[model samples]
Target: MEPPRDAKLLDPTTQPARIRAMYTDPDFVRRGLGRAILARCEGAARAAGFRSVEMMATLAGEPLYQACGYAAIAPVRSAPVEGVTVPLIRMGKWL
Candidate 1:
């Protein structure tokens, strides 16, 4: 996956790695793929010197994140897209 937006401009030792996106095939849901991927992401972030990881998670994804030990930071609304908006939760975990 691509590095988080503007990653080069941020200091890994001070800034959290942004988990820009994550997905699993519907047929593979609940089969541990998400958890595995998340673990890998955290490992990569930690290895890169990031102190934490964060993301704006859709409601459908919030449960999985929560189950994996991420804490909800706040509720946020995505910027309008062609007059539509999405509800999301900001969540993070220390690595």
Candidate 2:
């Protein structure tokens, strides 16, 4: 069974590893699941001796990541999703 929320730690193909495919079930959002998942991902990175972690954030998720200590690393960028376009921000945090 899937957990109430989810986060994935991407292997470090680049200098600092990246996080991708993170999400919380709508009903469970803001109830700490997302934070817990983010913490788990960071913990794993630290355990693996990584210096930092990075992720691309959808507009809706930017604030949450900011609260988790991720800083915007670049200007907002747009990408197509489904049939519409949305903004994304690149963010990074030291482990």
Candidate 3:
């Protein structure tokens, strides 16, 4: 499924590598599944010697990511989702 509005803040120029899209089903969002998936992804990146990972975040997800230690790399920006506009923030964490 396509991300919602506010899901477009990912700037390829600012990313360590091209950002890959990821998401958790809404029903599983509060069950720690998102964190688990992020942990696994980070672990694999770390094992591969990657120093960091990055993502563009929706307003709904920013807090959860922050709780996991991801921090903003830049101010929030406006992103278009479908034909709608939404706020987005660029975030990253060293692995």
Candidate 4:
């Protein structure tokens, strides 16, 4: 069974595969699942011949990605979703 926290498969692209989404249940936060899932994504990307893994990190999630060795590529940007614009940071990790 999947853990309460989960990561989506990377999106195929000409550049690095992008982590489509990742979420951890609030009740299960800070239990290392996020880091584990991130590692799995990187491992998968590397196995697939990708040189890097990228993602758009939610404002709240940015710190977690950063702590896992992802480097920021640009300043934060806004994306409108569900009638509100949320800040997201572009981050990538070399595989």
Error of 4 at 55 (Å): 0.3
**Candidate 4 structure, TM-score to reference:** 0.78
The number of clashing residue pairs in each candidate reads: 0, 0, 0, 0
lDDT of 2 by residue, 1-95 (tens): 33353356545545676788899888888799989989999998888878899998988889999999999998675555555666788999987
**C-alpha-based local distance difference test score of model 3:** 0.74
lDDT of each candidate versus the true structure: 0.90, 0.83, 0.74, 0.81
Q: Which has the better TM-score: candidate 3, or candidate 4?
A: 4
Candidate 2 yields a Cα-based lDDT of: 0.83
TM of each candidate vs. truth: 0.88, 0.77, 0.70, 0.78
Candidate 1: lDDT over CA atoms? 0.90
Q: Taking the tens digit of each residue's C-alpha lDDT, what string does model 1 give over 1-95?
A: 33345535557977788887799999999899999999999999888889999999999999999999999999999878778889999999988
Candidate 4 regions exceeding 4 Å error are: 1-14, 76-78
Q: Best by TM-score, which number?
A: 1
Give the Cα RMSD of candidate 4: 6.8
Give the worst 10-residue stretch by lDDT in candidate 2.
Answer: 1-10
Residue-wise C-alpha lDDT for candidate 3, range 24-86, written one tens digit per residue: 788777899888878887887666566778888887888888999999877576655567777
1-95: candidate 4 lDDT, tens digit per residue: 22364355544445687787799999999999999999998888878878888898988898999899888897675655556767778999877
In candidate 4, which residue pairs clash? none
Checking candidate 3 for backbone clashes, the offending pairs are none
